[model samples]
Target chain A: MTPLRIVTQLLEIAAALIAAPAFLGWVNQCRAWLQNRRAPSVLQPYYGLRKLFGKDVILAENASALFRFAPYAVFGTMVAAAAIIPSMGTGLPLSTAADAIALVGLLATARVFVSLAAMDVGTAFGTLGARREMMVGFLAEPALLMVLFVAAMISHTTSLPLIAEGLTTRALALYPSLAFTAVAFTLVLLAENARIPVDNPATHLELTMIHEAMLLEYSGRHLAMMEWAAALKLFNYACIGFALFIPWGTGTEAGGPAALMLAAPLLALKLAVAGAGLAVVETLSAKLRVFRAPEFLATAFLLAVLGLLVYLLLGA
Target chain B: MAPLSFDLQLLNGCAALLLLLSFSMLSQRRIVNLVNLLALQGALLCAATLLVAVRTGQGHLYLSAVLTLALKVVGLPLLLHRLIRRLNVYWDAEPVINASGTMLIGLLIVVFAFGLAQPISALASTATRSTLGIAIAVILLAFLTMITRRKAMSQVVAFLSMENGLFFGAMSATYGMPMVVELGVALDVLVAMLVLGVFFFQIREQFDSLDLHHLESLKETE
Candidate 1:
């Protein structure tokens, strides 16, 4: 690869890694503000990461290689995912390998690893969580694929950079298909990220937890990596959606030093708005009972299918 | 035009034959025999895809061919056969539609599929675009089979067979999908088979028959 492209990819990766913690903090601050309480500092998540990194890890006596390696795998997949998404612009060297479909595959791969590790310990809760995780993933993937296909049809390409470029540079007209898909994608994102109306990320209640239940046995640095990976994944998802839906602020093909500087603040602004929006969504929605998750996802599936039908029939 | 490459003709002929077999399996009601037809369909799909891969020099098609051979031809059929023997669902009691009715529906779907494929063929820019209609026919027929069959195992086989049709379509239209996609689909089919295998046991445990009409009761009826 050319050095310039490599440098750009490195920059994007660094930005993603640094902005991940800040993004988490920003969401918390927004939530606190909305609740009319004094918010923690925006650096709180960074501090948490630092403190976790410094602590030594304790492992279970029965921990297998899979359990020990899951953290790294999780972190690696998240980092790889972050690299593919156009956090700042569409000019990363990784763009060649960064297919929208492949992005979903990477997320699914990480999930499979994490679920297997969760089950390796043989705890009842862990097994329960793993089974539930698989069920959610099983239902979520087809919806996500259909969503991706909607965007793919619009751009005539599955590449993230190409999609972003097409959306931004092409006509300013609105697409009804993408509008439907965007809503469906937002719901899937909430469910996939374990947000409200699906699973409460804040709740440690064993009966209610989905993402958290699997992480119950983890502590210290391992937990930190998992947490950071989760944050990175949320960040990646947001950026991907932003690039796909709102690609205005990102730099163009002619990437000069000035373009890069402009993209930085633009991306930050987008994230801030997204963080607030996410907080509002989480605040407004109530967590559904676990049994109802299928109905919720089924609704998402129907919406996606409807979107596809609109695209096919209306020739959008 | 010069005679199509030997491998290309073989692939095309096999593709057409595979679609025909898929329609046959869709109309069949005997559970044991359906699984056998599905296995044969898988074998034909594997052979077709391999022929295309060899002619086009796309290495990924070989992997896809192997995947089809291992998963569809051998693994899934074996699982379904075992599921049938264990569940004792040698014959579906009665289809949701009789064989003749379902076959007539299948025939209509094939016509619609050809009509739908015309525009796709115009844009495909592939020698095998004509087979695209056959592919769509296979998929719709499988869907019809799923809707018409009473046995759960039959639906599962139809689902896998539908995937075979999609694979064939991709090969004929685009010379095969990306390697990563083929790999992902292969993994998905494997996992789906294993998961469905377990589900069969659970279903049999609950109902003592593989008939899926029982699952219709699972709907949240008002």
Candidate 2:
């Protein structure tokens, strides 16, 4: 509750809210460029969110309270997650309240709420989506935890900012464990955000969509919040990877106007590299079958565990 | 630490009761009685956590205690009850391992856990670290209960009871994990109970019984 950290947290939340839609739009733009197609405007996601937010929500007569409240819960959880992660600097106030492991739990809480709301509708697609979502969650959680555990072990602290600061400022010696973990974390990030090779976020095809399938019934502001939440989630996961693997250029805890100014461009450059990297991966890889997702996540988990073992045994 | 103060005695008694309930659960066959035993365990956990909170003045322990009360005591058992009612599986199903055999296994686990926890207990700075071995024993015994139980519902209860051991271990070793972690773990347990509740119905629907040996048939076919 230090005033300076509180101010940093508020600024970070505001930045995530403003930047998330643009990040999504940037990824779309990069995908289009890679595919040699005309690209949408950089602000297209933001515009879409705005239009949806201004419209009236239409709910099914059978919708329950869980269904109605899911979007808010989802959005609130993502907002909370963003506040805790150090997007611009390593001194977020909310960082004290939770660590990276709890961050994964927050995401899991949001996933559970959304999955329940999806199933509550009682449609065949909704149930299918809920089942698939839970399956993904069950497999993804351990991998995610192990990834965070690697970073935590390296820093000897679970605080996200401390992990970032420790890795960035530490000696430049190559840690093979972190190298494997970084790759594993990248795979998890892609799978979790519903990118290619695990899920096709762009397609609304019934048998193929995982994230989109759950959103079949949402419209208007509810849909907007969910989409914004989706974007926020993708942004958050990317920032988490950035904080862990590429911690350089994140401003220090002692806040100053110069640090803030430098952070803006550094963030933009980081986002550009990440968006393009995601597009390249998506373009190169094909989506795996639904049943095969367990194997994919299992590999991530094994890699993470292997990384932990290496770090523990060899102290690298 | 304080030459046997009231709070210390109450905390110790609560910890002892929690371990006793965990052992009873290891031997309990009837699902209904198992659920009741789990509730008792939760109550004892709440009392122990609250005593620690009051004694050490860590505000987060109070939240953890309330969470143990709500999720473990009230929430999960209720969910299990409803699942049992819906699945029509209140009666005792044959366990993969007999009760006496399971209790013997549990006794061995207790001894092993004490040996395993010796170094950790020595390192732990908390006054409750003496119970660390018990917490480990409870966790191992719960794991054994899950493995030996043929019924799916009983196994889920065992899984949840294992979480109780983990929470207690954290409390004894580190005064509880960070507040966010405790909350997240609580929410995770609640969500898991709900998901398992749904799974219970699905299992019964498919197999016509809550026996998980039916699920071993679900192994991947080439």
Candidate 3:
């Protein structure tokens, strides 16, 4: 790999690490605004992370090494995912080794480690949360794969950067198949990220908690890493959506550094719009009953399959 | 050629949407909502017919489109609404198969329809021939809806939707039927609605319910 490509890859990872929590903060702020409440500062997630990192670490008496190691593994997986996803430019050296399927595998790896650690704590809430997390993961994963498959079929490549490049260079016309898959992708994103209409991230009620219950045992810097990794996962998902569907602003081979520079602002603008749209959707839709989650994911899976069929039948 | 291809694309999109709506109708349980879906399907069929008429410049197809708009879109739905309001039937009881299972069967029916239409579509010359499978799927789905539904009102709506699918199939295959046949079908549908509307009131008076299962009890059993 050239020095510039390596530099671009490193820049992409660093941007993901720094900007992800702010993206969360932006969504939270937008949600507050839509709910007619005073909004929190856009840097609130950063401040929350800083405070957690500075606090003392607390370990449970029965905590195993897996509990201590899970945070790092999850954090590493998110970073790896960030590196592979072409958020700013499509010329990343790391992305060459990983395709869209591999990217999904990375996220699933993080999920598995976190859920295992949650089970290892031997707490009732921990195990309950772990079970619910696995349920959500099991249902969401197929829909996620189906969405990626639709994009892969359209581009005729499984690679993330190449999919972005392929979609970007196509003539500007609406693809009905893409429209179906886009709705499916949005549903999967909401479910996978513990967003509203799936699980409410802000809720700490033991009866309703899916993600927070698993983290109830964590404290201090470990918690900080876990929170940061969650933010990075959300950011990675958003980037994947952009790479597949709205890939216009991303830098291509001939454009080089100039295009890369332009891509940064474009990425920011896209994220801002996406975050706001997410907040609005969350504000409008009520959380589904936990048992209803299967139906929701099944609808998403069916819609993604419909998109594929539209392509095959209509050749659209 | 460019404009013709663009129109073909639009027609294909409308066909895909019609199939999706058919699936939605098969899974829908509310009697009122099923009537609304029937109206929507009629509107889409009318739109598709108009597009095909414009592309093929078939004057008879234009008249058929107008007839579809008048009878299917506006007139039938209005009559169904009035009948349901008078009969006071609003929701369908649970079907023999669940919603998801019905949808799965609908998907299978679509694949089957595609396989069945393959030879026919290959032989067809219309630009919208690819949608022939979708039309067949829509018809089969409407039949499925009719079999699963308990309420007579829902069955009537499904029956109307089936007519819609047949009309779409004919339009895609050969532009349209002869004007006399089209007029006969329209008259037949209107008469069927009137006769079914009177039959509903008679059944309701006899059994004090609109569920078709009530009529099954009228059979002579050992």
Candidate 4:
């Protein structure tokens, strides 16, 4: 609404776009270190993105306009999601337009577009990947909604900014329901982001890759945009988790540039810890067979439901 | 005394966990894992009893908590593990209803239990009376477990878990039974386990397997 609010929203989006690749690179570096392998520079994803953008575009002979538009749409949706989530501050203007349900809708829209484009190429791998991706989305979405519902019930609102403010302003008390939902959220995150025990992001074994397979037909700028969007999606999920569970250090009031500056470092600290924890989990767990994915997601859904039940029964 | 709200929250958490463990037991296929889950449930029950004991200053509840710790958590799991090793039965045979369907039915049973407990919970004055629904659900799920299991070992474990549910239900509804009754039930459980242990070996020796499906032949026919 106001100029200052607009400026902060733009600042948040820019920070997400720039820092997203760095977050991915940080996870990879941590994973390599954990495995005792020579670590790549944390700037690797940025370099890869640059290299990808400069390459020539390749399109399938049967590709339609939707194929061309899907990358942009997915990338745009990720940006919008990042803008709505309060990464640096909870006082953003965009947070009013979208609640947690709208956030899930944005992610689902991106998923649908990507899957449609994957199937458009008419390649066996692309179709296979699209089916697998949709399967994961179907199961993960319900669990995610359940998690959000638990949080919403506690804060008495579905709005992300309001929820963050509610949690941050309250005196810290141990919430067993939140504790259960936190675990459920982590599982949903790993599954949605193509992480270990669901789909391995780093693998290219034609039969095993879900997200990578969908992007096999893409090249050059489109590939770069898609890849960047994936990183941004990860960043958005991390921010959402931070907003719900660990909302401290996020600016609750719309102060001047000084408050924004103070919040940035704290955001960085939370992201660092999240990335490291993700790396450790990914390293320690083996990639589950694709057939086992349903059971994995079922467990997540059950855990989320259990969290809701705990809140209902225990008032915690 | 600890704050009433704090004690209730702890007890309710334990109740939630007990229900979850029951659901897990219903779906679990591995016999060894089922025993471990049962132990975890027992530990949670012990904690809940201790919290209740502290809140109400009930000395017998403290003794009951210790008894539950010693018998259910430590004694039962150890006995089950030894029985498992001696019997060489690890994985349960395919259940009558698959795991997911069984879980769905278990969920329905929980809803029913909650509805059934509403009036009783209203009448009960204990701090943990609200958990009566969960306790009943645990018991019913254990019964479901007993019905669906094809192996004798799993059935025994389910039976023990059902007893756990009854113990929990009694605690929530009436702050547990009299000490003499609790002791009597505990001894009854121990004796039943020893008897079942002997039965498992005899059945396995006669049938060369632990599957209870073979017992169907014992029915008198025209």
Native interface contact recovery, model 4: 0.13
**Model 2: residues with Cα > 4 Å off, grouped in runs:** A1-3, B1-222
Per-residue lDDT tens digits for candidate 1, residues A144-212, read 888889888878999988888788887565355676677788888888988888888767865878898
Docking quality band of candidate 4, CAPRI definitions: acceptable
Best-to-worst ranking by TM-score: 3, 4, 1, 2
DockQ score for model 3, please? 0.42
Would you list the C-alpha lDDT of every candidate in the order shown? 0.81, 0.83, 0.89, 0.90
Computed on C-alphas against the true complex, the DockQ of each candidate is: 0.02, 0.01, 0.42, 0.36
Which digits, one per residue and each the tens of the lDDT, describe model 2 over residues A198-290? 889888865868888899999999999999999999999999998988888888776565676688789889998999899999998888999
lDDT of 1 by residue, B124-203 (tens): 88777767777887888889988887777888888988898898788878988998998898888889888988898898
Candidate 4 lDDT tens digits, B60-163:
99999999999999998999999999999999999999766776687678778888888998999877888888898899999999999999999999999999
The prediction achieving the highest lDDT against the true structure is 4
Arranged by lDDT with the best first, the candidates are 4, 3, 2, 1
User: What TM-score would chain B of candidate 3 score versus the native chain B?
Assistant: 0.96
Of candidate 1 chain A, the 10-residue stretch with the lowest lDDT total is A306-315
Evaluating just chain A, the predictions reach TM-scores of 0.96, 0.97, 0.99, 0.98
lDDT of 3 by residue, B1-222 (tens): 122367887888788889889988987888888889999999999999899999989899899999999999899999999988999988889987987777778778877888888889899997888888888888998999999898888998999999999999998888888999999999999999999999999999988999898888656463
Clashes of 1: 0
What DockQ score does model 2 reach against the true complex? Answer: 0.01
lDDT of 2 by residue, B103-140 (tens): 55665676687678879988989877767776887899
Tens digits of per-residue lDDT, candidate 3, A1-316, equal 7776877898899999999999999999999999999999999999999999999999999999999999999999999999989899888888878899998899899999999999997999999988999999998898899889988987899999999998898766557778788888999999999999989999886587889989999999999999999999899999999998899999886688899999999999999999999999999999999988887887787778777777777677
